[model samples]
Target: MSDASVFIAGPASWNQIVLLDRLPDPVPHMQFAEESWETLGGTSAGKALSLRGLGRTLLLYAAAGDDDAGRQVRAALETADVPVHWARSAETERHLNLMTRRGARVSLYLSSPAAQSDRDDAALQAAMKASEVIVLDLAAEPQRLLPLATATGRSIWVDVHDYDGTAEFHRPFLAAADVVFCNADRLDDPLAFLHGCIAAGASLAVCTLGAEGAVAVDAHGVEHRVAAVPVEVVDANGAGDAFFAGVLDARLAGHPVPESLAAGAWAASAVLRSRHLHPLLDPHLG
Candidate 1:
């Protein structure tokens, strides 16, 4: 796998995650005790950092404002020895995530700095072509990379988090990915959607079932299931992305889907025990 490198294209944001006892109701004048901190968040940021913790050869490409938050992101990834290809913007994006200790979350997307889609950049083009795997998330900048990644003949992995199936913006990403992942929280019938992804030309499709675990369908149309590894939940902030990174790392190492799913489960368990993005990856990961 020497020639195989991963390229992640999407959004990276500075997030203030507030952990509460429980998600508050929509009533007037209610308060809950909360613990909060700033961390890196965003589909692209989470996946990229998680992948780095797994010791993959990766280049992360994403848009962020030229601000302190963006600097923090670069410093964190650099300290981990992961290279970044930052797309510049006027301001950085920010998210206010209200999470429950039980792992429930209500994310408020507070800011998005304007970014120009720089698909024509020479370095970006070279990275995409050299990558063995390309991970795309549902951000405008990343979406613009779909066609380019497809042209590279690299394995395209796209995470359509909370896709309800009928979202117009999700269809193109769905059609472009060779491997697909989603969560069961938004879909009325997640299993059906997973099946639909395979039918729509994906070689494999997966749906994370939260506490219920995860499921996948391979290219042969054989379905596989893996239960979540049980662990005392500390913070569930980046668990799903950790799961994806683990599976991706395993798959790149030539593990079968079932084994990869188990690896994903193990990786997710470690993330559940951490307070931030993927601080507890297994030593065996490298």
Candidate 2:
């Protein structure tokens, strides 16, 4: 295997959440308590940070509004040492995100028409051409990125966080992916979905089963199952991103499939034991 440098393109957003021991029957409103907010907690930045900690070079490409959220996101990525190679800064597009706690998520996506019009396709293609792998989150327009995938011939990876039940919207990108990652619960039968993705030309398919474990189907159609490392649970928000980062890193380092799965599981376990997805506490990154 060759060392892989990834370019991630998608929305960068802030995540704010409030934790509760149990869901209120009437959805009680609290004046204030302990709340946590991440300046940059979207999938793209999270994956980039996880990969960076594993010593992989990353080139982040995305559009951000020239506002506070964008500034804060850029500062956070800079602190995490992720390279920003093809970012388009615009006064129009605001950062978008979802807030979640204990498996319940609510999205606050920006659907401004001007945002779509501001995308710089040429710059995105330039960055894709320079990368060994390109990973995109479903938050962006898949149609806009598909041509780049075809033009570069670089490995493409897509993380499906939202499913609309329409095959047309997803099939094109799925067919372009070298690897496709999705939460197990997102599919009715993960094994079946893996098969479909494989038939669509995905070289690798991963379905994360939360605390249970994760399954991966490789290029040759071999299925591998790896259990999550046992750990005291804390937060689950970034577990999937960490696992994906691990798989990408291990593969880039030329590790075998079994070892790669183990590393991915270990990375997720580290996230499970932490309050946040920040990699400073993860021993696996070293």
Candidate 3:
């Protein structure tokens, strides 16, 4: 395994920020002035920033349209020093994400057939074969990549964001992954869900409770808990991803479970203190 090689596959988007006095009771529909647009946000950008700060070689596999947004996305990655093996398709469409000051967020996604299409298995296999670890979004086209990861004998890590009560649909992919990280709000009982994930095949499971802390379970059924670092949180957007990157970095460095969790906790806290999701500015991050 190469010490600096990691693969991340996900959707990238251009974010437009709009500040309001308060989120309207039922959401507003007025066309705002041009000043409402603040900054652009991309999930892949955040992930790449976090991983790159750890001195890891990032390989992002995703689709972006043949538009200005796509050009910006590519340019942003290059600026961040993340290498891209992008699979560009003419049918890709740009995604729009809206961020509000009251901690409410919504996304207007323009879906394209090419963007939703599965990645090439052969290319992914080649990358996985040479990578130290593979980080993926469980919400992505798992059917295409999960099996390939399992077949390649690579350590697979998945980020679980949205769960719609259908465990059956997600079980196969979860079982195939080596590590699973999820936000606490996504589950009813985190410990029970960890056990279920272990039963499904995950060797390690971590549940990140936003402000409270995080809990991690190893393959031997041992549980380790890490308390959240004390900080004034400006935004809670990329804390989980920072935590995931920290954990992976520690594990790749051969740290034990407890130490790994500590590193992750520190990274999460650092991200919480930032106004944005850029992980490179985190003081606690290595």
- lDDT: which candidate is best? 1
- For candidate 3, the clash count comes to 0
Model 2 C-alpha lDDT per residue in residues 32-91, reported as the tens digit of each score: 324454435667767887888788888776556667767766766677777774344453
- Flag regions of model 1 displaced more than 4 Å: 1-4, 115-120, 280-286
Candidate 1 lDDT by residue in tens digits, 135-230 = 988887777777778888888999998898899999899888999999888899888888888888899999999888999999888999999998
* TM-scores, one per candidate: 0.93, 0.82, 0.82
User: Can you list the residue pairs that collide in candidate 1?
Assistant: none
Of candidates 3 and 1, the better by TM-score: 1
Clashing pairs in 3: none
Stretches off by above 4 angstroms in model 3 are 1-4, 18-44, 90-120, 139-142, 164-169, 279-286
